[model samples]
Target chain A: MPALPLDEAGKYVAGAYVVFVVLLAVYVAIMAAKLQRIERELRELARFAEQRNGERERERVTTDV
Target chain B: MYGKGLRTLSIATVAALAAALSLIFFYAPLDADQGFIQKIFYLHVPLSIVALLGFVAGGVYAILHLRSGERRWDAYSYVCIHLSVIFAVGVLITGSIWAKASWGHWWVWDEPTLVSFLIVFLLYATYYPFRYAIEDPERQARYASVFAVTAGAFVPLNFLAVRLAESLVHPRVFATTAGGLPGSMMLAFLVSIAAMALLWVTLVKLELTAKSASGQLKRLRRALDAPAPGAPSRVAPEV
Candidate 1:
């Protein structure tokens, strides 16, 4: 849909540049979401480990008392 | 702490991305030749360069791991290669769009730019299998590192070969903005690069975390599956 003589080449180039920005922005957003999800999962795992550790500590105190 | 690398990389990347966008949008001169489509050049070219750099990082880390016998180096190597792969995909997609407008094709084998990208893609595709083939962690890391190191050298060589084997139908990269582009445009371009690099590091860190978590999970499972300290004598007798 672009005409010749390189007059509109500038327009085409501009279009390409715009597309790049949009793509990059989208990519960053997706990565951010993925990172957030992974962090959430890690938090859950850490909590599980902490709970197990707490239970063991309680058992030790009961025996000592 | 994400450490200096992550922190600097993250901040720099975000900032660069912001700057790059602004430059391209507002400051950079409209191409004298390619016109509007030329704008894609700012994004497309930088991506290829970044992807190439990513592979180089992987390959270098791989060599270091092999020489030193450090398992951690292998982790870094794998991460670098992974980042390179992601960037490579970006290059291909953006390049294809650029090609369609310029050369009127979604795909072309002979274009040096396209050819370089494809070879890089193929090179990286094999990396994952190399990663997963061996069951032993140390062994897997050792062999994979060697492959990564070797692959890094070959990517450049392959790129050079493409140039030699066929004429570059596409425009020479970075030529447009190389000659005294306006200040704002320069800033935007730099910002984009920084943003991209940061984001790449973030992904690498994420992958590294996943790798470590999986390893720990395995250890936990092993501990659970192990037999109890005492014998089965907890039961009175075999009925």
Candidate 2:
């Protein structure tokens, strides 16, 4: 096939590159969301551990006193 | 462990990709046949190659999963397939754009390579539903591994069939090193392939790390007897 004129060909070339970049960006965004969820879960788990530790300490002090 | 070299991988990927783009635009000569539009070749072909290989890798991991009965291998297979599916979408879309630019149509029925690739993509597309359909985790992983291996085996056969179908008439400009291309074009092509491969590895590692984190979170919750956070993932096997 004969190549399209430079002006016309530019659009398709641009479109192809844009599609590639956009897809990569979308994948990165999805991963970012997953990372955010992981952070939240870690925070929740940390808080849960801290609460349990506090409760155990309180029980121990009460028994001693 | 998955994130161990992620930073270095990311840096190397960026460096390679930047070098590729520069070489593509500045170093590579305009094609006598396709001109600037041929630039798309650098992006499209590499992605196609990487995605195809990823499917095969997924199948390899699946085989390991089946042999060892290790859920981690299953997780690896799943992530590889998942990433490849995403890349496949880019392949089809970019390929369609290239086709439209070259042939004046968004799709062409007569092109064996294009058709074969589409077939491969369609075959892998069924993976999600297939996994979703089976409720048993162990059974699902086993069956999915089998499917991956079967599909992976089909890839090379499909390529061979396509080559045989149009070997003489349609010369493959896509395979840069196969003899026709100029040295500059070949260099850009190789660099692009390297970048795309690195990008694939980086993304796969990122995903596996994410899954590992999620799995650890689940383990923590179980240990603490903390009420389960939201519904568990139905399709994705936790590592």
Candidate 3:
């Protein structure tokens, strides 16, 4: 194959690099989504714990009365 | 603990990647024959090599998992294969681009190197579905490890077969008779490989950390008798 002119070859080279970067970006996006789900679940768990603690405290006050 | 040093590793990967890109574009001399188009080699070859190594590493972890009957090793094996498959996708796309630029075709079936790589990629691609097919967690993990070890062993044999095959289209840089890569090109290639390997390790650590956190959360839920939010994953082994 004949050597491609610099101007023409540049596009293909750029395209290859672009594809690599795009794949990395997509992977990052997926990871970010997973992290978000984890955070949401943690928040729910914390709220549940707080709710349970409040119920226990209310029961103690009624027994003292 | 899985996340320990993750920050340092991430910083190091970014630095190495920057150095590699600088060397590839500015330092490495252009190929006399392929010229600028050959730049893709630094990216494509390193990704392919690292991905192949990752598969092998996954197999090693699988062996450890089987011997110790530990779930952590299975998690490691899963992440290694997971990242490798992602890297494999990058390899195929970049390889196709390079092929088109050099040979005027996106794919050439006659080339053993290309076909063998595709075969390896396809084989690893089935891991997820094959793993999910088994309903029992213990059985699933055990069977997946066996699959990983078998596929991992096949990788090297496949590579060796391609190396021995006579091929006119693909360039063989490692052949001693071919005079190999020039010094500058070799330097760039080595650094690129290091960068990719570091990146792979960093991603694996990150994934394992996330899985660990999830596992801990499940433990907490069980201890507190909190209702589970959703069904557990059938494929991803608990860390």
* Deviation of model 3 at B181, angstroms: 0.9
Interface RMSD, model 1, angstroms:
6.1
lDDT of 1 by residue, B1-239 (tens): 22336666667666767777777768877666555666676777677777888898999988888888876677778877877787787788777877777678878876676776787799799888766777677777877877887889988888778656646467654443455545655566666666676667776775666555544544553554532222221110000
Worst 10 residues of 1 chain B by lDDT: B230-239
Which lDDT tens digits does candidate 3 get at residues A1-65? 98799999999999999999999999889888887888888899999999999999999999999
**Per-residue CA lDDT of candidate 3, range B117-230, in tens?**
999999999999999999988888999999999999999999989888878579876766856998999999999999999999999998898889888888888888899888
lDDT of 2 by residue, B1-239 (tens): 88999999999999999999999999999988888888998998899889999999999999999999999999999999999998999999988898888878898887788888999999999999999899999999999999999998998888779866844433485554556878899899999999999999999999999999988888888889997778667767877
Best-fitting candidate, scored by lDDT: 3
**lDDT by residue (tens digit), candidate 2, A1-65:** 79899999999989999998999999999999999999998998899899999999999999999
Chain A of model 3 scored by TM-score: 0.94
True contacts kept of each: 0.27, 0.90, 0.76
Better of 2 and 3 by TM-score: 3
TM value for model 2: 0.96
> What fraction of the native interface does candidate 2 get right in terms of contacts?
0.90
- Model 3: how far residue B7 lies from native, Å: 0.5
DockQ of model 1 vs. true complex: 0.24
Candidate 2 global CA lDDT score: 0.90
Question: Which residue segments of model 3 deviate by more than 4 Å?
Answer: B230-234
